[model samples]
Target: MKKDKNRYTVFEHEALYVHRGEQKLSDAQLKAFQLFYKERDFPYYSLVHNGIRFCEYVGVIKVGNLTIEVLPKADKSNGEEHWRSILIDMMRSTGLFHPDSPSYSSLKVKNSTILDMYLELFATEVERLMHQGLIKKYRKTQSNSTALKGKLLIGKQVTLNAVHQEHFYIEHTVYDKEHLLHQILSKALTTVVKIGTASHLISRYKRVLLDFPEQRDIKVNESLFDKIKYDRKSQSYQTAVDIAKIILLNFHPDLSQGSSHVLALMFDMNALWEKFVLRSLQRNAPDGLEVSGQVSKDFWTPETGYTKKIRPDIVIRKNNEAVAVLDTKWKNIGDANPSDDDLRQLYAYSRYHNNVPSYLVYPGNENKSLSGMYSRAFVGDAQTPGGVIKLKVHSGKRDGMELLNQNISAILF
Candidate 1:
């Protein structure tokens, strides 16, 4: 547990200042950040005069030896550790990273960063895989062999063996560990070795690499992971491969600058929050009720172009009929009203879904449900619609998911 002076921790929607002689950022590091910001469509942080202001995205950002961890916050009194744990829980709930919980003793020492958690999980999986034995696949290879093999190439044999009479050119299939899955895992292990700052995990990483077989490294990217298809033989590697994708895809190294790189493992809080609520509702919904998120329907279609779709965040149905529409917001609108855009969006959902009830859900101190209705002028109808538009908020001191279930039950059930 050595002290890392280069690490900085901040909450979401907070700023990490980097003025001259103010923050420890060097000129090269600043340029690296600038280039990273310009090259990618990263929406997690916005550039400020002194430094970067993190938005509603929470995770770790490593620039060379420097580590910046942005954590989620619901209340100002909550510290970084609280939000870090909550973030991990949310990710687990959404089936993102499947790591076992880190011990409480480690939290007290204040040594492990988010990146360390990822490396630990990845190394642990690799260890398990090594003990079980790495899977091998048959790959095609071509070369000049002393004896004839599977397929003899007449043209190559005549051209190359003309010089050496004892040689034979052939193409053959060899069953071994050199395959796509091994290549991906090997690349991820090397990535951990390169940028890892946690002292304890370095030895674990090296140990895993020692037993792992050599693999031909390919340029890892998002598409490479998408191209993978798992079968009965490779099903055991699903969890390890999922974790590997998170590690390799989020990593971006600055090649032009010396030893300066940027690795961001941030998740959009808005998207994560929406997904959390959707999962909770899906799991707890009663027998007859159906819960679906991002239910899209065609909104408009041109004569020649593609049709536009309108999706509601959450749609609730009972007995095969659309009953309610819910739009979850991560921001707290305590004692205040939701924005006009939010109301309008819900209104559109209600109108399109046969005027079923709509509600805007937010995070707050308690479930202070507000009820209202669309007026005649607003609805553009002869009489006002009976379907009510409401505001719902949920808060919990012990378990947020339980409170969320109670609030949703009270509203729809």
Candidate 2:
């Protein structure tokens, strides 16, 4: 099948209607997605009548022969291609799965999908690591050795080597490239080869796998990635490992659905939006002002349980004093009043942060920043703390980062 024939593109919160026996999802594929939703427990999409409505999560979800690409949407009128590029740029800004400089141009020129880009990135990392030489680590081996290079187990030697005196049963340590990190990367390369649809990416992955050192295949899990510790020797493999983690962890093979595999490279739009804004602010912050994210404050303490903490999305400080608090929303609220819950949340954040000005940031058609004040700080208090809650809107155009940087400049300076 042709690429366009099999690919279905939809925006976030948009519905992709499933046809019974047409160009859309088949019954088996729909069942596969249903099983994925049930098993993964992540609300990537919700089941509608004869359709799958994608939520805030955006990325590629490959089910059998159909490739569904869900891209983020702040403006409902924008087409798929525009949002695709914006999504790529946003992912790059947030240090998510993005290709290196060399591979990036080729991918862009070829107009590759998210999966293709990720696979290309992984392959590029593997190629770079191979050129730099794979790191070797000390691994213990238990075998019969002709040369006594390591410790000899007396009991094993006595029992196993009784017949053959020429061979000694020993436990020895040897430095080699076969380790957890390499094994994980190797597994990811294999996965990329399996689920990857792009011919170029598949070939590249295969070539890298050929050059990659032979590693003992192990069952990869979330815990295995946690065990990887990068030192000076293995520091260069961090990007490859991170991409590999994303690939291997998200790739799920459905046995009940037969040969269909579900690979969902989805990101929470809310979190990504917050991170992008935070990174933009951090990069463009002025002198004597610091920008931090997920700054926590103890909101409540229970006598028998853990204390509840409130974390603002982005908090700005000057000389360790809370100057401003920004809460980012990925949704577009045009010309309408802000939600009461959001306003109240910002109010709470302001009250906790010593009455600092808190802003509710959103993506809008144009740059609009408005300042408003709470008439009274509390219901009972007659006096107001004079804490202001501002609304800052970023024009989510192609130059969104630049616009966001400008917004940050205006707030910080």
Candidate 3:
């Protein structure tokens, strides 16, 4: 038996040899494969059993160079009604989807076709934005007009291209870029449907695409963000602009020129986990405190004349002063302890900010708490003293407001 040359499949954390497998990949494709994971600060693939093993993040991402055959993770959704609740919850944490957002609350991560979940979420957002009214911009148009409209295609008259055709006179018309909008939506809809098989998606997407039936297909690198104007009259399109940015950047039409042309609806678990915790804490934060992410620090650079940079994942500020810092990791520490890399990162973030309460938050509990000191002495510090606290808050593991409420309560308290 042989797999398709363009398709490459592997289970979560499983491995396959792309260079020497049945679906042998080229050097460019392999680089694209490694680049995606590496950019997220994770080892994209592991050389185990002579195959490429993916990390826990499961979804379809086109390397265009290759189609990742991603299977689901070992942990089933425990037969929860909305098994895909994890994805929904994680996405909700990003603040991209408003709590009151329509067409999103009912989404579920089913046992099979998890990739479909991403498509649905993306489409749901797209549809929501479409309902808000698509942004329109005056685009210069050139065609033979039945009646005189604007400037004529004057240069073409000497060329005798359209001048001879009196019935369709050459003229320019400033029209809305509705055609461009259609192209973008059509391309994204086409890509999402092709990503996976879902009977329901076809109709939903068909409806969306049907809205822009007259519009053409957009090409790679074609974007209208810069071309469109943002004013009070067009303020309705803010959400559409945001959604369009995500779709244009992640959606792809074909597997050409590598990942650039491939649609990547997948999200990095590490980032998603961190954002979810931060947002959860921020939303539920006490009245006296505030939660912020990637907080800049107070530092002065003497030699380079550039301020020393250190950004903690989530910083809890009390009345504008950072009181506590929390770094979220998506790893599970069932029995094994937190890794040194995580420890050092949190320790430095603490020390750089006047010895604040630095904490390491993992999704799983090791049933034990540990702390250590780091300083200039390489063992301890006195002036800028700091330590690391390992804590667990599995917000993504289970559904229901109870677990989420508990996780947030435990992490913050």
Candidate 2 segments whose C-alpha is farther than 4 A from its true place = 1-3, 20-23, 98-110, 377-399
Model 2 C-alpha lDDT versus the unseen true structure: 0.77
lDDT of 1 by residue, 1-413 (tens): 34467877878897765554434566666666777888876787888775677899888898888888887776555666666667766766677766343322233212356677777666767777788899999999999999888899999999989989788899999999999999999998888778765567889888888889999879987789888999999877877787788888988876775477677888899899889878878888899899999999999999998999989899999887888888878887667777888888888887888878787877665556777778777666633233322223222255545666666666667
Q: Global lDDT for candidate 3?
A: 0.59
| Highest-lDDT candidate | 2
Between prediction 2 and prediction 3, the one with superior lDDT is 2
- Among all windows of 10 consecutive residues in model 2, the one with the lowest summed lDDT is 383-392
Candidates in order have lDDT scores of 0.76, 0.77, 0.59
In the predicted model 1, the residue pairs found to clash are none
User: Residue 341 of candidate 3: its Cα lDDT?
Assistant: 86
Better of 2 and 3 by TM-score: 2
Model 3, span 108-175: residue lDDT tens: 64332334554576567667666766656666666755676677666665465454566343666465
TM-score of candidate 1 relative to the true fold: 0.89
